[model samples]
Target chain A: MLSCTGYAARSASDPLAPFSFERRDTGPDDVRIEILYCGVCHSDIHQARNEWGNTLYPCVPGHEIVGRVSEVGTNVSRFRQGDVVGVGCMVDSCRECKSCRDGYEQYCEQGFVGTYNGEDRQGRGITLGGYSKSVVVDQAFVLKVPDGLDLAAVAPLLCAGITTYSPLRHWKVGPGQRVGIVGLGGLGHMGVKFARAFGAEVVLFTTSRGKIEDGLRLGAHEVVLSTDKEAMARETGRFDFILDAVSAQHDINSYLALLKRDGTLVQVGAPEDPLPVSVFSLLMKRRNFAGSLIGGIPETQEMLDFCGAHGITADVEMIAMDEIETAYARMLRSDVKYRFVIDMNTLAASA
Target chain B: MLSCTGYAARSASDPLAPFSFERRDTGPDDVRIEILYCGVCHSDIHQARNEWGNTLYPCVPGHEIVGRVSEVGTNVSRFRQGDVVGVGCMVDSCRECKSCRDGYEQYCEQGFVGTYNGEDRQGRGITLGGYSKSVVVDQAFVLKVPDGLDLAAVAPLLCAGITTYSPLRHWKVGPGQRVGIVGLGGLGHMGVKFARAFGAEVVLFTTSRGKIEDGLRLGAHEVVLSTDKEAMARETGRFDFILDAVSAQHDINSYLALLKRDGTLVQVGAPEDPLPVSVFSLLMKRRNFAGSLIGGIPETQEMLDFCGAHGITADVEMIAMDEIETAYARMLRSDVKYRFVIDMNTLAASA
Candidate 1:
């Protein structure tokens, strides 16, 4: 076992604080990463606070992981020492499952090994996540980060980027397509960027009128105040695709109506309470409501390469390791412009 | 105006009674059809009783129409004398809308004119449906019923056939795929037949084991009693697609669980109350809940052609025009084995 440092919530009701942990030693196909920056996702807050109720104790929750390859086992060929790398959402999965063979290991039927709060194949103990100093993972699950993109900002691209990217690609969001993005939060911001980069005419829908200027600057060609009935009526049955990134529980039917015949709306937000979806909303236009998790390994790499080629990076606020607690607090209030990335060098200096 | 004899509901709550009606003279693009047989649908019951709450007075409730061409206007070239034809759910739509132009006129932006209890472009009077001796419709809305299929048994194909076929076609049901058809009503039976005809391995899901034999006869490779937990559990996360055709409210999430990762369950049955779809069901497998109405004109023709080629037709119960009221009563009880097709020749003879 190797000693490591991270942040953990002692209990469900407790906030994250400094803690020490241990990671399994590198195996023959493992690559040990020194985590460079980890993006704080809304899911991290849900797990750290045990919002979904199954959260385990000493939960070191983070998944959007970007890092440096400090060491590699003898058999590892995908990465070597000093390589830039990333690990999003999962650390391991049964390689023999149908999902693993299909490149959708995120939905492994045998249960995937999560970056945090999930059991390994043997069901030994909970897996600690990327808020830690280092991790040992099978090389097959590690992604090579593109050389020139800012590693800190690129962290969110792994989770947020692919979460939005996968659906856009699956729905074929492309030229001459009018795409509507609901919300302008961390996920919505990425949706706009990707839709625009994919040659779509992007519209951002926000209830807050204040986000209008910011949404346009983030790559949206138009901003509609969702609260305005006139604006909504003007756009009804106009969109070819809608990416609903709003986490807050609201009327999904409103967005479903905005779609043209056979159009689709993909939800990436995992809201706790069940949303009431009107069947007529979908039947009316033969519309579809689907949910997509982060992309498969092949697609995630494709998204990163697309972002790199398009000169895209998340709008991230950098902070010292010690400021994480405050960053999480600000995150709950939607205080960050987009995302918060932790600078790993501050971890050693603070230690 | 042309006078016609038919049965209609005087009000939303009225039972079926004899009524004489009128249809406008054929326009340049119109074709006149002498009604032969009209299939009964669950929606006919919903509209006759105002179950969906918007049925107009003098509602002649029927859309799945089979008839012979009586005459064609000068500009109508698609059909001539002696052509056997059919009409499904709609009669007219704004032809210039994106949905109409894209071959999804069922979802026309300006709204397709419902075959019954709906108004026309001028909004002069409520349009009458095919529960009458004859109908006048735009040539674009008339479909050529192939010579091979039995006309009475093929009436339901206009509605139930295209309703099920559209979704199966959209989802790409084919060989090596496991498909599930929920419910054993009019739509479910058609769904099972269509899915099997598309070359998929078909499984019919019904609440009662009594439907086992009937399901296999209708082309199911197997039948699963949906109420049997052990049987359902044995097939969890296994289906590539599931068509849910139950009209009454039931647990939608139950059927959603049967879908494999990235699988879809399309709802053709409109339940009264909104279903509370669990986010976990969608999130875990990245699944989808989609809805489909009766198909567009082109697809309906394709479906009719496919059925003709496959020797497929609804297992129908024939009834005289006077038996329509009793048929409605039986439909309400789910007492009818399948569809009720009214013999228009009996109607004309009675007149």
Candidate 2:
């Protein structure tokens, strides 16, 4: 086993502090990477506090991990030493399932392994996340991080970026299509960039009026303050696709009212409260409400290449390893500009 | 204006009492139908009690209307005296709107006019429904009921029939498809029949095991008791489409979990309470929850023809016009076999 250190939450109420943990040594099919930076996802806070009721203790929660490869197992062909690689929400799956064969390993019939806190195949110990110094994962799940993009900004691409991008790609978002992206934080920001890159007329839906300029800067053709009824009324029954990234409970039906016939609204954010959807909203126009999780390795790599081609990456603020606690607090209040990326150089010094 | 006698709710709590309402003289585009039978719809109860908050006073709640044309306007070409016709939920719509032009007048962009308690284009007064002896409507919204199907049992074909049929047709249900009907009442019965008619393998999922025989009798290839975990597990991720027709809020996520990847569950019933959905379920399978309203006039005519050809009609119990209140109560308790059809002969004798 390889020894590593990461900021860990010992209890639900405990602040993250330096803690040592053990990761398995790289096996024949594994790659060991020094995690360069990790994107802070909203789920990190949710899991750390056991908000969704499935949290395991002593959690080191991070999934949007980007780093430089330090070592590769003898049979690992995907990466070599010093290769820039990324790991998203998943690490492994029972690869024989139909979903895994169909490039939807995230929906593996036997369940895909999560990057952190989820049980491993042997059901031995809880899986640790990417908040630490290094990680060893099977070669199948590792993605090549493209050269020249800001490494810190590219971290969230593993989670938030792919989470939004997967739905857009699955729905075939394209030219002349009107796309509505709900919310304006980490997931929503990527949604805007991806929708724009997909040649869509992107309209950003946000509750915060202050996000209008940022939304526009993120490549939205328009920003709708969702609270404005008149503005909403004007755009009723217009969108072809709506990527709803708002995790908090809100009026999902109101967004449904904005969709054209056969248009779909895909939700990636898991709300703590259940959304009350009016069946009439979907019935009247043949509208659809769907949800998507972070994508698999193949699609995640596709998202990265798409981003690399379009020069798309998250607008991020870099913080040191110890600042995750404060970053999490600010994240709760939606205070972060977009995403928070951990600078792992700070972690090495402290270690 | 002509005076028409019918049953109507003078107040929200009132029973169906004798009332007089006005009918516009046949315009060039008008067709006046003498209603022979009106199917009792669950929505009638909701509107009569103002449960959905859009009820108007002196409401005559019947949209599943099967009637005979008593008169036609000079320029009306679609119908003439003695033609059998029907009216579903919608009565009027702006013909120029995209939805109206696309033959989806039920989803008219300008908000399609309801058959009952909705304002007409001229804004003279709210339009009444076919619970009355006769209704005057624009020929565009009137559908010709096919011959050979029993008129009494075909009334529900105008509403419940088309509501289920539209989604089945839109979702491309066809031969060799595995379709699940989630309830066995008005809409689910129709869904099972239609899916079977479309040459699909129909499966009925019900909370009641007693419905198993009746389900197979209604064209279902098999019946699965939804409460049985082992039975549910045996069919996991298998259905290509699920038609959810239960109006009461329940575990929708459970039904969603039954769908195969990229499958859809269309809700035809309106539950007052919001259904609680887990994002993980939908994300895992790429499943979709959608809503579908009644079909357009063209499609309703097609459905009636389809039902007629298949010898399919609502399993209805005939009742006198005076028994509407008791019938509604029975309908709410699931005491009726499938539908209640008012005998207009009883209406004429009583009046």
Candidate 3:
């Protein structure tokens, strides 16, 4: 076993604090990563608080991971020592499932193993994620970070980037398309960038008027105040595809109506409650309502390559490892620019 | 205006009684059809009772129409007197909208006029349907009824038939695919027939075990009792497409579970309440929950042609013009197999 140090929530009601843990030794087909920067994702907060009621505490919650490869098992041919890499939401999936075979491991039939709060495949204890000193992952689940990109900003790309990228790619959103991004949060900001990079005419739908100038700067061609009934009504049946990144419950029907005939509205946000989708909204124009999870491994790598070419990186605020609890409070109010990435070197120096 | 006689509901509480109405004279681009047989639809019942809350009273409800052309204006080159023709749910639509220009008049931005209880496009009066002795329709709205198909049986093809066929066609359901048809009502029965005709393996889902033999008889390769949990559980992720034709409020998630990865469940049945779709259900397998309205004129024509080639027609019960009130009561109890067509000769004899 290898010793590790990270932040852990001792219980559902307890705040995350410093904790020591252990990880399985690097085995054949494994690459051990020295944790560098891990992005603060909304799901991390959910798991840390056991909001979904599935968390195993003392939970080490992080998946949007970017790090340096410090060691590789003998059979790990794709990666070696000192390589920059990433491990997103998933670490393992049943390779024999149809989704895995088709390169969509996120939708594995038996369920993909979450990077944190998940069972380790190699008989180790519960998997601790990238908020730690190091993580040993199967080479198949490891991603090579593209060179010349901001490594800290690249952290959110593992989860937020792939989450938004998969749906856009799956729906075939591209040039000459009018794409709408709902909610100007972490996911929405990335969605706007990707849609614009894909040569689509991007429109950001935000209830907060304050986000208008920021949205435009983030690559949206226009910003529509979604709260304005007159403005929303003016653009009825206007979007070719809408990427709804609002996690909080809102009327999805309003966005569903904005889609053109045969258009699709893909929800990357998993609200606590079921969305009351009006059947007439979809039937009216032959529109579609769908949801997407974090993408498969190959697609995640593809998204990274695309981001590298497009010079796209998440707008992020940097914080020391100890500030995660405060960051979580700020995240609850959506006060960060877009994302908060923890610099894990502070933990290493403290150790 | 041409005088016409049809049975209509004076108000929501009133049953159908003999009423006089008027239709526009045959204009240069119009064709007059003397009613022969009109298929009763579930929506006809909904409209008569103002179930949808959009019905105009004194509603003469019928849309699935089969008739003989009584007269054709000079510019009407498609049909002449004595030609067999049919009319479905729509009478007229704004010709300039993108939906209309693209041949999907049913989704016209300006709204397509319903066959009955709809404002007349020519300023004559509220448009009466084929329940009357005669109807004047735009030449473009008239479909040439193919020779050798039973006219009475073909009447339901205009509504239920096209309604089911459109989604199957739109979703590209074809050979070697597994298709599930929910419920054993008018739409589901047609769905089974169309899926079979399209060379797909059809599975009919019904709550009643008694429908098993009838389902197989209607071209379903197998029938799954939807109420049988063990049976339903055995078939999870078994279908590529499931056409939900059950208009009654039921758990749509159960059917959504039956679809394979990337499978779609299209709702053709318009239930009164919104279907509470679980987002995880769609996100898990990347499944789609969509709605499709009745097909466009061109696609409806294609469906008719396909039915004609495949020797497909609705299994209908013939009734006199006065039997509609009793038929409506029977329909509410799911006591019809599977459609009721009124014989216009009974109205002529009474006159």
lDDT of 1 by residue, A54-123 (tens): 7876777778889999989889987999999998888788878888898888888887788887765543
Angstrom error at residue B102, model 2:
1.5
Better of 2 and 3 by DockQ: 3
Assess each prediction's global lDDT (C-alpha) against the native: 0.84, 0.85, 0.86
Residue B121 in candidate 1, Cα distance off native in Å: 2.6
Ranking by DockQ: 3, 1, 2
* Residue pairs in clash, model 3: none
Over B114-137, each residue of candidate 2 has an lDDT whose tens digit, in order, gives: 888776677546677767788888
| Candidate 2 local lDDT, residue B104 | 88
Off by over 4 Å in 2: A1-23, A48-59, A122-126, A229-234, B1-21, B46-57, B226-236
Give me candidate 1's TM-score against the actual structure. 0.92
Q: What is candidate 3's CA lDDT for residue B207?
A: 93
The predicted structure with the larger lDDT, 1 or 3, is 3
Alpha-carbon TM-score of each model against the true structure: 0.92, 0.88, 0.94
* Candidate number with the higher TM-score (2 or 3): 3
DockQ of each: 0.68, 0.57, 0.71
- Model 1 chain B TM at 0.93
